[model samples]
Target chain A: MAAEQGIDPIHQFRIEPIIPIHIGGLDLSFTNSSLFMVIVLGLACALMILGTSGNALVPGKIQSAAEMSYEFVGNMIKQTAGTEGMRFFPFVFALFMFVIFSNIVGLVPYSFAVTSQIVVTFALAILVIAVVIIYGVMRHGTHFLKLFVPSGVSPLLLPFIVLIEVISFVARPISLSVRLFANMLAGHITLKVFGAFVASLLGAGAFAVIAPLPLAMTVILTGFELLVAVLQAYVFAILTCVYLNDAIHPGH
Target chain B: MATTETAGTEAPGAPHEAAFPPFDPGTFSSTLVWLALTFGALYFIMKRVALPRVEGILQTRGDKIRGDLGAAFKMREEANQAAAAYEKTLAEAKAGSQALAQETRTRVKTEQDAKRKALESELNEKLMTAETLIADKKASAMASVGQIANEAASAIVQHITGKPADMTAIAAAIAAAKV
Candidate 1:
């Protein structure tokens, strides 16, 4: 009966291992999150292949679209991260593509939301943060630790300032993960609820002829979801750029 | 944060655990596995092929442009040098032509002056020879006139006396006639 209502949008957030395998007492089985991630990757690849296969100077529709997306993310990285930040562009671009692909794929029937899962999102966020820290430390040595110290602070206030900075710094992964997951989860849930409303209304026959309103709402919500998918990806990339800036320049 | 926390508390079950419908997690797992594979392959293609080709093309274009510019500069330099050399040769030719013309003019003037002097000296010698010939002719004529006068006086004496006159008288008559 619950399945007939279609997978509950809220229930879609649940993480369950596909394989019952346990390795060293840890269940490393493939999860629903992993499945959506694969779909997202496939979509990204197919899109990229279609885009670049023409290799036409005067690009066709697909190529132009791909080039546009690349330029868009590339410009954003350049603007926020500066020229030095260009080194991280590929990773950022990939990250954005993956998030966007996943979100859109999640809109498909019977698909799981990869971003809705905390573990996956958290893993990605941690990877970014780890890279920033490792790269920063390697590049700047002990000076990387100097990121906490503000230049103009009073000596008495320096301690409090450093503490606040440390807390913010530690909160990076949390914020990054939460932002993606929350946005995906909320958007999907809203889309589902609207979809459910239309389905329920249409079941009422002539009495619920107004069911088309919910259907229209669903279409509108779907469009909004697509927008959110793209927006979330952009936001994620920009945040990464900002974080990279911090890593490169530190306190400033 | 409180709103999120409250919402989270209300939505705490694995949406798949509901038994009325068997929630297949395999689909999700399969999708994820394929996504990872695709992502890996695409990333590889980008790193290995597309990016390198684009970079190569850009580099080739840059090199071609630079090479063309270098060639143009070299050509321009060569043309300039050729023009300079041509101008120098032209100047030399002009100088040579002018020198030749000047030398020819001077030689011609010298030759004309020598010819004019020779002509003038020859003309002066011809005038002296003509004057000498006229003087000799005049002297000879005077002598001839004296002799002719003597003959005529003798003839006149003969007619008057019907006898031949003596040499001393004749000479005296001739001398008087001559006076």
Candidate 2:
């Protein structure tokens, strides 16, 4: 346990560059994170492209998956954001696929989780907010500022309510980013810790008897992580739709 | 583990950030770049190729189902029309046959009545001739019976008297007896 660096739960998130490319003071090097991002990209696109390649009227398993994913995102957008919010369907679908694929691909024994990085989640969250802001302002002009003001609040408490609303509005990206990052980071760390516990127990002499306990815990956590992975992706997509809804129809 | 070892061997950028990777600002640029590249590519592929194909498949399936329903409905309607025509033809033929049977019945009845009338008239004519012959026979028989009586009376009287007796008396007696 003293010398095992593999057991360091935080070590798995380390980003070592596979291809170091430096351009204009930016470390645009492709790291393990980037590799896995590409992997996620490949996985997601492959599922979509290959699954639909046959274009079968009666879909095969893979084709059903592809169709289900499309309808899943499509219906999500329609239900949360309404038909008008369909303009952002491509973006929302992309985000959902990326996150879900990243989560799933990361579950591989030695793979790095791209979403565990806060910067990555923050970037995606920022993108959603940026769309909301840019399109909201462009479409509704000053009326978009009405998003901060409640329609039915008494004028006496309006200032406080508006302040709270502004804070909440500003916190959306932070909350959105942190929510996903924290969940992935915590879940992975727990998995790593428990896995190390099992390994450590197996390496121990008499304590090896209880190795099944941690192993079982790891197995259960893995299952839970799979759920979290999918649930988080759903949460991400649905929230994106809700935000896009504001962009399409501002206020109230 | 290979990745972690590789990270350790890489030029240690900073001691502080190296302890925890998520907080490291050093990898932000690369992460962001990759996110943008990958997400942009996904969006592009989905929008341009995959989604549209799926949408097209669903649309085609829907159209095919609707077409099948329409064709079935059309066939059913045609069947109904044919059945109706069959029923009409059957009713028409039934009515025509019934009318024909009625005509045959009336014609046969008329012919039978005419033949019976003819037979009855012939029988009546034969009966009238027979009656007239019987009447003539009776009258002749009556005249013959009177002659036989007159002879029998003359023979008896001649035998008893033993004489040719009085012709005038005899003639007068015979006349009174005839009366």
TM-score of chain B of each: 0.64, 0.63
| Each model's chain A TM-score | 0.89, 0.97
Clashing pairs in 1: A11-B15, A34-B32, A35-B28, A35-B31, A35-B32, A38-B35
Provide the lDDT at B61 for model 2.
86
Q: Score the docking of each candidate (DockQ).
A: 0.06, 0.37
On a 0 to 1 TM-score scale, where does candidate 1 land against the true structure?
A: 0.62
Candidate 2 chain A least-lDDT 10 residues: A1-10
| Docking category of candidate 1 | incorrect
* Tens-digit lDDT string for candidate 1 (A12-48): 5655567554334333356666556666766776666
Scored by TM-score, the top model is 2
Question: On residues A168-190, what C-alpha lDDT tens digit does candidate 2 reach at each position?
Answer: 98999999989999999999999
